[model samples]
Target: MKILAIASAGGHWVQLLRLKPAFEGHELIFVSTKTSFKETVKGHKFYSIPDASRWNKLKLIYSLICVFKIVFRSKPNIIITTGAAPGLMGIIAGKVIGAKTIWIDSIANVENLSMSGQIATSIADKSYTQWPDLSNSKVTFNGNVLS
Candidate 1:
């Protein structure tokens, strides 16, 4: 399977990396906002997009464009993210291209899903919450990346 794994820098990137083992035997392509993350995902295909936040309207638009281009060229069968804005952009682009998407809410959101996670619940083919208590009709609690 061709998998496009995307996440922003910092905690989201760390959490996304932890799921690498789960994607074993697949053709994994990674996308992050920082070029510095290339070292962490050595030996895999990696792409860097501009970092943006919900608060940054202009940059977010540019990031979305980058996501469209990457997703189009990669032609992944699946797209997965433990996210922030950049991850959400990947999910949106994946949806537009008819690729399946999985959104794993960060373990740090112990109390509730992040804003991006909540949005992903409606768009992602599968949406997961690390906390069992947060599971609902739209989101499932399978296993966590941290575990």
Candidate 2:
């Protein structure tokens, strides 16, 4: 299976990378911020797209375009993300192309999910929560990614 792993840089990217062991037999493609994550992920099929904050509309639009480009080109079987904004873009693009989507809520979101995770809860094929007791039916208790 072709797996497209999407996330922001820093902790989100680190968490996503931990899943690499689960896809040992499959081809993997990674997408994250080009500038902040250049050195973080090495020896992988990587693509750098713009990273956006909540107020950054221009960056979001550009990232969406890039997401479409990546999604159409990769045609991944599954799209998995641990994110803030880019994950939402990947989910939309992946859904348009009929790919399965998974959203792993960030460990940093201990009591509540981030904005991206909240949006993803409505669209993701499945959602996971690191905090086992968060009590959101949309998510399963996946434990922390670090553990």
Candidate 3:
């Protein structure tokens, strides 16, 4: 099975990398906002897109296009993201292309699910929260990524 794993570039990337062992047997394709991350996923495929945020409309649109194109071409069996904006785009594009999407909210958002994580609850096939309190009908209380 092909799994497309995506994240922005900081804690999101770190958390995503922690899940690498889970992807051992599968074909893994990683996407991030930094091409510099290629070295980290060295034997697998990697792609980079412009980092964008809600505060930046033009960059966000461009990023959405780039992410959608990658998702469309990869045709992955599953898409997973520890997100901000790029992962959200991947989930949306993944769904459109019939791939199962998983949203793993950043662990930093203790008070609530991050904005993108909240939206992902309705879109992704599965959504997870590190905080049990944040888990509900839409999101599951998965064990901590750091643990």
The candidate maximizing lDDT is 3
In terms of lDDT, model 2 sits at 0.87
As for model 1, its CA RMSD to the true structure in angstroms is 0.9
The TM-score measured for candidate 3 stands at 0.98
lDDT string for model 3 (108-129, tens) is 9999999999898899999999
lDDT of 1 at 7: 96
Best by TM-score: 3
Model 2 per-residue lDDT tens digits across residues 6-81: 9887899899988888888888889998655656656668899988876888878988999899999999999999
lDDT (Cα atoms) of all candidates against the true structure: 0.94, 0.87, 0.96
- Candidate 2: deviation at residue 116, Å? 0.8
- Candidates in descending TM-score order: 3, 1, 2
| Prediction 1 global C-alpha lDDT | 0.94
> Which digits, one per residue and each the tens of the lDDT, describe model 1 over residues 13-97?
9999999998999999999999989999899999999999888899899999999999999999999999988888999999999
- In candidate 3, what residue range of length 10 has the lowest lDDT sum? 138-147
**Which sections of candidate 3 miss by over 4 Å?**
none
Give the TM-score (vs. native) of candidate 2.
Answer: 0.93
Models sorted by lDDT, best on top: 3, 1, 2
* Worst lDDT 10-window in candidate 1: 138-147
